[model samples]
Target: MPEPHQLAADADRAAVVTRLDESLADGRLTLAEYEDRSTRAHGARTYGELAELTTDLPRPAAPATPAAPGPSPVARAVYGGAWHGAWGNDLRAAWTSWLVTGVIVTGIWLVSMLGSGDLVYPWPVWVVGPWGVVLLARTLGERRSRGDRQLPA
Candidate 1:
């Protein structure tokens, strides 16, 4: 875990603001208080400052959607440590596959054209397109299952 005085990232600031919003909705904080704290949260440069704003409030509930690469409840419960984005690594592997397959397909197409001295059918698309589609479908399904149906990168 980072020291509270360390610089806060956008995600950290966003999380603190979200807590303020929830506190407002629950009547734990007045609109004036929420606005004041939210403004300070946006301007805050360190985790220590953000923590001061929420120290009195209960921790917010976990969002249903899978969060961005960071802490996870299950990881903390089991391993007592923050997550290291192991789940997101799958997408990286998928992208790597796309890059490798695209290069191979393009190379094949170039070789075919050079040998035949004519632009024949772009046969590479046949090899790569369906594979890409399958990967996309699989990624979407997995994300949907996790309640994170946003577009994959």
Candidate 2:
């Protein structure tokens, strides 16, 4: 698993940008400086990079304790903890359901096709397609909402 500090997400960038905006409004930074730092903050790919953008200003969020830089095998060995953390908190459940539903539906479809000795209309698609579309929409909506919230990194 990647170290916690190794990557920054959209929410992190948004938070730094908010802090930069605050600084600009309060006369701590000029327009050009704010613009430059805002761009850099959005582009930052790690916590350290984001932290640097607001180092001179009052923190907009809790101080990001630099997560341990090394990939700690011990940290990852903690079963559900690292597994959930590996792909953000929500991915494990979504991915697990995707896999399980796919396999079960495929299995049932195969049995139906073989039992009738014919591949007529692929009916399993009815179940799988709608489920997949709904899941995709939910995933995308969650990301969009999270980006909008930008509560913290």
Candidate 3:
């Protein structure tokens, strides 16, 4: 169920299986390696589904496949950064964002309460808290999608 081009490029799905079988027979690939690649090949439903498809594949001299660059800034900002990560990376990143945003939101509430009319309705924590959480989730989602989390300390 890979993409049109993937299916066409190796259109003969059977061919890849045959090649794998041949390779395994010749000791070019081990049973473990074959299973890993086979799982990925079968699990992938698109050209870009390559990441998970090959997650367990043994490291090669060069990656047999790569991930898509992913969504742009604007896209991420609006979508809450959900369209990202190989497996659950996006979800985890979103939660991290929520945590950070929660702190920011609490600060906003405290500041608003301290600066203006004590805990007033006009400037509500409900409004700020949810907004801050959403913004943080979106921002982190984009950063995670771009693999920024991989940066060195």
Candidate 4:
């Protein structure tokens, strides 16, 4: 480890500022104290100076067990582990839009059919189907890529 007197980088100062912010949020520091510490943190020139600003704060607790190296529980439960991380979040939003669009289009089709007093060919399927296929393909591709990264047991 570098000596405490070593020059602090901007990231080092920023990290101390973040800790001070957390302390303020948790009510460990009054606004006045937080402002003082935050200003000091930003102006700190060495590791020792930065460290002094947060020495009174408790350290973050370590997880009891190492976090499982995989997708989050919500993703696993909802997506069967095919979707995760940032890309998975994007996939979820896309699917949500698709579902909403499908519902709206299907509703319009139903209303039009009722007005005509005759069965009309369902056209909403054309709007929903191809988009669904593409989303499914992307999901499967994500799953396959995740599988590829696993070590053989």
- TM per candidate comes to 0.40, 0.36, 0.26, 0.48
lDDT value, candidate 3, whole model = 0.57
Per-residue lDDT of candidate 4, residues 68-110 (tens digit): 4665577766766665533536677778999999999999999
Tens digits of lDDT, candidate 3, 67-124: 6565566545675445554453555465666677667766777788789966555444
Q: How does each model score on lDDT?
A: 0.77, 0.71, 0.57, 0.83
Worst 10 residues of 4 by lDDT: 144-153
Please report the TM-score between candidate 2 and the true structure: 0.36
Best by lDDT: 4
TM-score comparison, 2 vs 4, better candidate: 4
TM-score of predicted structure 1: 0.40
Name the candidate that leads on TM-score: 4
For residues 69-97, write the lDDT of model 1, one tens digit per residue: 54345644663331223355555467578
Worst 10 residues of 1 by lDDT: 79-88
Task: State the lDDT of candidate 2 residue by residue for 1-153, as single tens digits.
Answer: 235478988988897898888899999999999999999987889988887787889756576688544324543354212322324555547667877888898898899889999986777688678877876776665555544332222
Error of 3 at 150 (Å): 27
- Enumerate clash totals for all models, in the order shown: 0, 0, 1, 0
lDDT of 4: 0.83
For model 3 the TM-score comes to 0.26
**Model 3 misses residue 113 by how many Å?**
0.3
Q: Show the lowest summed lDDT stretch of 10 residues, model 3.
A: 51-60
